[model samples]
Target: MRRPAFHTRLRAHASACGGSSLIEVMLAVALVAVSALGLIAAQVWTAREARAMSLRESATWIADSIAEATRTPSVGNAALNQWSAWASVLLPHGDASVGESGAVAAARVTWASVRDRPTAGDGIGPSAEPCGGVDAPAGSSCVALAFAQ
Candidate 1:
């Protein structure tokens, strides 16, 4: 048989190595899968954060409304009870409490916060701490407001 040219042999060898091996293909797929998972986790975290923020805003609005109502004369228990009931409906695991001593009146609205999510620092329940304050019960978030007549 006649000998093949050196260039032809090199071309054949190059063609043989051109395609990815099974292991390489698997590794590439695995890498892409990992990246996709990370993206999904980030999106979930973002959504959770957004929901938490919305809850916080609602709590603030409720607290403010209660405080404003307290400023009016003869703000009856029925009205306050209605406000609390409305807040409970508007937020998850929501509760509202109002207290009055002398000329000062305070209202607090507490709701369920996402547990096991770190905020600012890695301290346990840090995410709930700001909203819940020291009075936040375990596994709950809170917002409090006060008004003086």
Candidate 2:
């Protein structure tokens, strides 16, 4: 057979190497899949964080509302009486605008705090304040507690 030209040999080599080799294609696909999985996990984590943040913020608001409610003699008409002892109480209170569930969660800042002042009327209760309206901030519920010395 006649000797093959250098150009022909190079062409043959290129064809053999052209397109993605099986290993290269597999690696590329795996890399893409891994990146996609990572992105999805990040998104999931962010979503969970957002939910937790909302819950946390709401909890703080509940605490503030308790304090505000306690300052008055008739806060929630005797809902905040339990502030003297560190106790947490959750009730179906607040605006339904957050959801039809129309539920509100109230908890003593802490069991220790609950006993701070024995003098109490009640703890913050549900529907103590209007929430979930344009006038009210989002994800915040205000409640009134009836507390006194």
- The number of the candidate with the highest TM-score is 1
Tens-place lDDT per residue, model 1, 40-103, is: 9999989988998999999999888888776776885666787889888999889887866677
Cα RMSD for candidates in order: 4.7, 14.7
1-149: candidate 2 lDDT, tens digit per residue? 87669979988998988776877989999999999999999998788677655544554555565556544546643544443321233322222111112334333332111112223235534322243222333223333222232
lDDT of each: 0.78, 0.45
Worst 10 residues of 1 by lDDT: 125-134
Task: Rate residue 20 of model 1 by lDDT.
Answer: 60
lDDT of 2 at 60: 52
Q: TM-score of the candidate numbered 1?
A: 0.73
Candidate 2, residue 35: the lDDT equals 100
